[model samples]
Target: MYISLNEILKNSIFKSVTILAGEAGLNRKVKRISVFDCPCNKDILNRNTLINGDLFITCLEQFQDNKDGIYDYINALIMTKSSGLLIVTDDCIDTITKDIIKICDESDFPLILIKEDVPYAVIMDTVNQYIAIENLNAINTLKLDKIMYGSVSNNEKMEILYSINPNIGQYLRTIYVDGGFDSAIEELKTHILYLNSRDDIFVRSNNYYIFILSADDIKYLKHHSDATALKVKEFINNPKVGYSRIYSRKDISKALEEGKRSLETAKTMNMSFQEYNPLSVMQLLVSVKDTQEAHDFYEAYVNAIRDNVSAENLKEILLTMEIYVANSGDYKATGKIMNQHENTIRYRVNKVKGALNMETDNIKFNETIAIAVKLRILMNEIFY
Candidate 1:
């Protein structure tokens, strides 16, 4: 990101200087700075060396007697696409005329005034230092972005990961947020700063703001009874949040997919946040990249139930099973979702198990049934 002229003025070296005009141009980017000496022979208007985005700084000593020349100089700087102008004023050229200020305001061209005592070298150094920092930040952000999207080569990715966090452990977890772009960025930055995890990188991908944090750090934040974590949760104004399971560095692509899947699930379920569950049949279904394979898997799992049960009963059973799996097989919670007594839920579950002819004690049987139920739901979402 480019550093705006407003930020340069906030620097300690330039803080004492006054912004005389062009408040609207404060956001103009300063890419380079140059000292414009009043060249006697060179045509200042036609043959000026200043480029489009350069910040032109000058003493304006030559224009002391020829005030009209100042107007011409300002016009030339504007025509050259100079980012802004900084003029030194004192006994030599103490004041900018009303006409020059008027032209600057009309053009929305930044015109800053510095006291003559403040050496031009100081201003140049400060602006250059800021530009350098901004450039470095931009480079780092691009590297991190490439890593997030799995675009970096293995060697380069490892180097960037090491540079970002030398102690990067065995696992990484991604937190993806959707909505409240600018506010969420600010709040998340505050939260990360408070946690003292400045090494973590935040990047915008598509419509989501993806935050990459160490798995251990996220675990601490989620489980530890820290006020900072609580404050972070309160401050994050996002409408939907998704978190991926811990994964090795080599599985970053899978981790990103899991994060996106979790986000989609959160949106579908109208949830504030959702974490990817490795055991979730929905997650498994989403993991299958080929649509045909996913469809075939769905058919293999659901064919038995569809053949054995009536259409209406299958719908009821599927709903019951979905609630059962969602509630972690808790009969009481599933009953609440079905708006029935615990005994009723048990009866329906037993009936469904009998119809499917599957042993509840068999882990594979239960997993297949869960997948079948989820697949049916997903199909309904598609066809309906």
Candidate 2:
């Protein structure tokens, strides 16, 4: 139960602070606590509350922002060889308290919320007794939001995590590496850097280091598993040293050859169509071996539906359908988004069915067509 002393003080009043400090006082043998001041001047009076404790209580809250400062404090705690709290106090609830709750839920920090009415004697006694209780802690979904909002942007993290977990990509900011970086292939590890489009590299922390590399680059690193991550981190951290060649010399040539082959494969697989939006369809068709047949089937499907389908009308229908699927077929919400009565949407959808030669009422069929339409738009853009 490693806790930040600052978090405990930030959320409660002077009375609660006294209770917390008193309980901590009972454990004089445990002298690793580090105390920091809240940015607010009002909370400075509580500094004596933590005096003569494990570590001195001053200038600890260096991060100005509540979330940033709290995270900084947490990182400092992890850096230290102690198992105690860091006390920080502010007059009211704010980012510090929010972040503290976040960290408490994310990792084990044993957060004990103190109300002003609770006497210090009762509170400390209760906390000491209740502290032994394990597994009563709650895991809220808010942790994910906290991680995103409190921590650094997810761009670099997403790029690296996507290699191991692709499903998290859409929910995160992506990191992209320039294809032109191939010229410095040998220094790949040493000079390996991933940045958002704006070009800020992610700094690694105890929990994570995020880097975005192309699929081809990720594969290359996987091939040279021995020194991939370490080399990449070194390169990103010290790009000026130009260690790019040192770590990547052994596999640069091989990686370059593989990268070229991958590019060619991707190019060959790209599908295009001009008459209709077929982007999503193009992705599906790329995997299909019989491209000519796929093109013919798509053309036929479009021709049959074109006369009845105006671009705007089809867009509305498709957008509604996508929303429906995204909402798991919430008819009321989907209808509202379509700007048509639910029954009218049902009717238009029925008409779409007659044109597509499928059962409109069938959930599976409608879902499939909706997906296909999305694909068609993407494919058309690619081809055009």
Highest TM-score: which candidate? 1
Global lDDT of model 1: 0.67
Per candidate, the number of residue pairs that clash is: 0, 25
Consecutive 10-residue window with the lowest summed lDDT within model 1? 223-232
lDDT tens digits by residue: candidate 2, 1-384 = 322344223322324543322233223222233334544232433453333223323323454445455565544433332334433344333444565565544544332323344434443433332221111111111222233344534454344333333432111121111122222222222222322222222322222222323223434433433243334434343221101111132232222223223222234344111111124343344454245665665556555556677766765655655566656656777788767688876776666677777864587665556555544543453311
**Candidate 1 Cα misplacement greater than 4 A, ranges:** 7-19, 35-48, 88-95, 114-130, 148-156, 163-167, 176-199, 202-210, 215-242, 256-384
For candidate 1, lDDT tens digit of each residue in 75-151? 77777777898877655554478888898899889988876467788788777766765565566556666766755
Error of 2 at 288 (Å): 3.8
Error of 1 at 299 (Å): 25
For candidate 1, the TM-score is 0.53
Best candidate according to lDDT: 1
Q: Global lDDT of each model?
A: 0.67, 0.38
